[model samples]
Target: MRHTVERAMAAERSRYRRFWVAEHHAVPGIASGSPPVLLAALGARTSTIRIGSGGVMLPHHQPLVVAEQFLMLEALFPGRVDLGLGRSPAFTAPVRRAMRQEEDPPDRFADDLTELRDYLDGTGAVTAHPVSDRTVPMFVLATGQGLAVAARLGLPAVLGGPLLESPDLAAALAGYRRDFRPSPRAQRPVVTIALDITVADTDEQARALVLPEAWAMARSRVTGEFPPLEPVAAIVDRPWTDQTRRRVEATVRHAVAGTPRTVRRRVEELTERTGAGELLVTTSTYDRAALAASDTALARIIGG
Candidate 1:
């Protein structure tokens, strides 16, 4: 994963805005469990690109600790650190128990967000240190309630997953803008859309490139575990249940994968629908070479 980030991102540093790592604990498919640790390493390898979390799940840790960690990151990297916060719970019941999070826990997201911001802004009762004058911008990874919280608090929002394809998407974003409050952190509303994007020579090839991720997600829904990505040939040769096939098809349909022109058109449509200022490509495939090529093609499409 580190090698992929270094090659795909650092190679074309000017093409990317931020290299955002995700936080997933005890998920067999995901290697990253700590965003801060990963961000520190990525930041050292690249100079211009922003390093941040796609996000850190706030429910898993205290607000102060989060603030201190990001602040330390800002100190190390200076003006190039971002902190994206999310309210997602642990992966499973056992993982939740392991993390000491209650099953169906009460939502403390808004409260935690407020406290964490206070520490970053040096307004909390206790200061989180290695503090500097520069601010580490915080973004909320919005789903449903998260949008409202972000709007109310005057923070930028990162929207992804099924929400991007929701019938009420425009309405949801409109509501976000309609109810948004401006703060010192942000004087205006900013929306960034996240999707799994892949580019290849042809539409079929592009779709195939995303099959491993789609397959993994499909099986995870039924098996209760997100297994490691398998090669495209291995995935295709294996027998799949009817349910798996449907789920895989659904996932593949959601991902934007095709030739450069095809991808550009889809991306433009997303921008038109969401009025998003940025696109967060979360594409993952087992073929590292193909993935890198896709990244390169995607960068070219955006004139990066």
Candidate 2:
């Protein structure tokens, strides 16, 4: 993954806006648990492309600590750091136990966001180390009430998952914009939609590219363990139960995968529907080379 991001993504630096890593603790399928640590490595390897978290889950850490880590990142990367925050709980009960998270933690995300911003903007009661005047632009990984929080705080929202395909998506975003209160960080509402998108030479090839991740998703649902991605041939050779097959089909159906023209058309429709200013491609495949190729094709399709 690091190799692909360092060489493949960095190679197409001009065609991509940002390369964001995610935070997933104690998930067998995910290797990187800390976004800031991974971001530091990725930041050192690439120079131009912006690096950030898809996000750092705010429920897992203190707001001041989060600010200090990203501030340290800004000190290292200068203008290339962005902080995308989320309030997702741990992946499972065991994971939550491992993180020492409360069984029924109350939502303090809005307050944490305020505290984090204060530290970043140097308005906090206590100073965070390596503080610089440059504000590391913040974005919320929003869904449902998350959107409302983003609007009230005057921050950009990074929306993904079922919300992107929700029937009420238009109304939800409309409400966000209508209720948005401009802050010093942002004078207007900004929305960035994220989803799995794959581009290949042909529609068939694109579908094939999505198989590994789709199979993984199906298996995770059944086994309660999100395992490492398998090769397409390996996935094809294995026998799948009817439920697994249904889940795999459903996942593939949700993913945007096809030739450049096909992907372009769907993307245009999504942007038109959401009025999103940015699209964050979250494509994952067992084949690293294919993933890179898809990213390249997507960059061209989006005229990046």
Candidate 3:
């Protein structure tokens, strides 16, 4: 845990502007189920860079609890906190039951988001202690109906590559931008697209770094479980069926990885195509040193 936080500090030192922790449940080999705990530590350790949830899965939690937690984060970090939320349901039926959340009707995401917003603004029956003071901005992680929610509520949306991968998605996002209603908190529609961006000294090195996670992704699909990342050397030596190789290739193909120039050009194209205001990047590698090295190389490319 300390190591991960330190890497975030390193990323900030390397001039990455924001750090977001995700909320996941009943997942092995992932550690971001409690965004508040992680974000608070990050808020205390780093200065200047924004710290946020990427996000709190609102369906599994109470709106007031979510409001108070993020408001407390804002209080701690002052002007450097964000409240990113997603309406994703629990990962599985068992997990949903474990959280004591109903399965049929499910949690009312839109209403919860509205209530959370009201709590943040001190306009609800329940007051969020310490008061949000309208300083902490809320961003919705969206794709389908989630996008509509963001548009209707006039909040910024954070979309992943899946939503920016095709023309239909681009068109949908354009519609979102066109029909969005501005709230007092958000004056206009803002979009941030998340991508898997990896950069290294050479194309081969960049691909090699992605191999561990990519292969694991393929292997997990076949095994019905998401496995821990393996070393690249081990992944390279695997005897794979043709279908497995194809699956692995497909998983990594969504990413843009290469030498700095190659990555930079692709990034420019991605931004132009998606019309996104910010880029949230996710890079995964088995070797910690290689990951950090890639960030350093990218830092130079971005003049960070």
lDDT of 2 at 184: 86
- Estimate the TM-score of every prediction: 0.97, 0.97, 0.94
TM-score of 2: 0.97
lDDT of 2 by residue, 82-112 (tens): 9999999986788889999999888899999
lDDT of each: 0.89, 0.88, 0.84
Separately for all candidates shown, the number of backbone clashes (residues 3 or more apart, or on different chains) is 0, 0, 0
Cα lDDT tens digits, model 1, 133-205, are 9988999999978999999999999999989889988888998999999998889999999989999999999
Q: Candidate 3: lDDT of 179?
A: 79
**lDDT for position 279 in model 3:** 83
Better model by lDDT, 1 or 3? 1
Window of ten residues with lowest summed lDDT in model 1: 5-14
Ranking by TM-score: 1, 2, 3
After TM-score superposition, what is the CA distance of residue 126 in candidate 2 from its true location, in Å? Answer: 0.4
* Per-residue accuracy of model 3 over 173-251 as CA lDDT, tens digit each: 8778887999986889898988888888898889888888788778766765567788988887879999889988876
